[model samples]
Target: MQNSKLLILSSVWVEPKSSAAGGRMLQLIKFFQSIGYSIVYASTASESEFAFDLNALGIESHVVQLNDSSFDGFVSEVQPNIVLFDRFMLEEQFGWRVVQNCPDAIRILDTEDLHCLRNARKGAYKKGVLFQNEMLFTDVAKREIASIFRCDLTLMISEFEMALLENLFKVDRGLLYYLPILIENETIGKFDRRLSFSQRKDFVFIGNFLHEPNWNCVQILKNEIWPELRKCLPDANMLIYGAYPSQKILQLHNPKERFFIKGRAESAEDVIENARVLLAPIRFGAGIKGKLLEAMVYGTPTVTTAIGAEAMYGNLPWNGFIADDNQAFVASAVVLYSEEEVWKNVQQNGFEMVKERFAEHSYLYDLQTKIGYLNANLKSHRQQNFIGMLLQHHTMQSTHYMSKWIEEKNKK
Candidate 1:
């Protein structure tokens, strides 16, 4: 029998070393490959220097243009059995083309995180008010939720967001699938080989700086968290690492204050493994944190806020500590860094979290089974999702004309 074809419409080329979303995309590619799918990855975004080479993995890579009917012919020729959108925005942009060209293709949207939820929280944080579900009713929410309703299945990274969608947004439970940041079993096994507390030094914070939440976390560390933290542990250094550090982020580096902004690590695993403690006091964001999971893989304990640890551990004890207040966060960091026994225990918790929650073996089979069932009953599935059908019909019509108009305008 011929292997099935899967076409992925990505907003950006995969850059696993640069961002968690990139890593998640890579994981999804591997999962589909393991299920005997011949994959074709196409993106409208230009390739970055750090982008992973999908062709190296035997996956076909194509550069696709937005608002162009050329994509219709391209997708029709590929005729993928499954068409996965990297994020909701991609679905909104290219979904209609895919639908008009290949109606039988099972469309899947990977909601890397709930952008609506994250944006709502960011807006609330900016206003110095606690985030409420009512805050979620934004223009972005309308577009994102509509994108969700237009797809056959949407992969949700956080269980909290999944419940929020079902309860707050009134989305059907059948449309959402829970798939967290998956770690390879072999990677989990390397936890024992990570540096011990005595061998490691300094406090580390790593993320992609282009992300607002990460940039905000860095500011919190500099102004609110680090001054107090440095006084508590004067000898230890605070190292910040991330990709695309703007001038403002670079200016935050002060060797005199022991707060150094080291832009982008060569290897996330290497730096994370060497650090005694990873600190991320994320005030607002959605989705499971990739850096925190990387910490678990490297046996590096962390001190993060409740938002950073949300839906990550389930009922399992966190790898280190979750503190919302600056004082409490500093206190946890000092104790975790100072006590070897406590650090070791927390490190063990990380290993356990990896083995139990994120190991690919636990989720991959279920994902495959779900995909198989959806493929077999695609027509009935679409029939049952009335909202999805309605949104697909109406939204795609509007989006289709808008795209064609843009394409014509561009020609002039």
Candidate 2:
């Protein structure tokens, strides 16, 4: 039997150290490689200094162009058995081309999170109104949902989002798959060696500042949470760390205030493991947070909002406290920071949560089974998805011609 070829169409090159999305993509890539698949990664986005070296892993990396017919020829050449779109936007850009070139290939969409949900919550937060499910009805939602319907299967990071799509949008359950970010058993074993609560000092907040929610979160930490928190614990410092820190973010750093803005940790695990408590006062966002999960792996308990803790922890207790109000958030951080016994207990909860929720064994096996089933019954699967077929037809006609026009315009 020939080794199956898998092509990944990514919006950006993976930079696992920079963001959770990058780490999640690396996890997926390693999983497919383990299953003995030959992988090819293609992206239109420019590579950064931090981008992962796919060539080092023996994976072919290609620089693809938008609205270019050359992708049609490239897809035909690779002729992969599976084509994974890194996100809905990637699916929208290259999905039609894949269908025309490799009709037999299984199409999978990995939704890092529901962009529509995040956008709606952000809109509500900006307007100072409570976010409602009704707010989810936007043009972005329409585009994202259409991309979901067009794919054979979609990997959802949040269980809450899976339920939302099925109940609210009435999307067929067969098209959605729950696959959160997975942690290897080897990484999970390092929890015992992490620094004890006493050995660690200061509260740390780390994220990719390019993400709007992270920037918003930092502002909340600076203006609302940190001010009260510092007053309570006069000696303790608030350390902010992330990638792509803008001038505005840099200006927030003040030695007199004991609030430091550190840019780009070379090792996120090292920074997180040494922190006494992780602070993420996320007012609005979607999906299970990568930062929270990383804190768990490193035995660093966190105090975050309900929005930050959403769809994480499942029925399990949070690693630390979940507080929405600024006062409550400050109080929780203080308590988690001061009480040694409470800190130790919550740290254990984090370890257990990681073992139960993110163990890679079950998810990887299930993924294999899903792909096998889809490979054998692909024709029947497509037949059962009438909405998908309809959308594919219309999307192909519209996107196809529009792309052709863009390609012609670029020449002129």
Output the number of the lDDT-best candidate. Answer: 2
Q: Give the alpha carbon lDDT tens digit for every residue of 1-412 in model 2.
A: 1499999998788999999999999998888898889999999998789999889999999999999999999999999999999989999999999999999999999999999999999999999999999999999999999999999999999999999999999999999999998999898888788899889999999999999999999999999888888989998999999999999999999989899999999999888988999999998889989999999999999999998988888899999999898888899999999999999999999999999999887699988888889989999999999999999999999999999999999999
Give the least accurate 10-residue stretch of model 1, judged by summed lDDT.
185-194
For candidate 2, the clash count comes to 0
For model 1, the superposed segments whose C-alpha errors exceed 4 Å read: none
- Clash count list over all predictions: 0, 0
Clashing residue pairs for model 2: none
- Candidate 1 global Cα RMSD: 1.1
Show the lowest summed lDDT stretch of 10 residues, model 2.
1-10
On TM-score, the candidate that comes out on top is: 2
State the C-alpha lDDT per candidate.
Answer: 0.92, 0.94
lDDT (tens digit, per residue) of candidate 1 on 5-88 = 999998789999999999999999998898899999999988789899888999999999999999988999999999999888
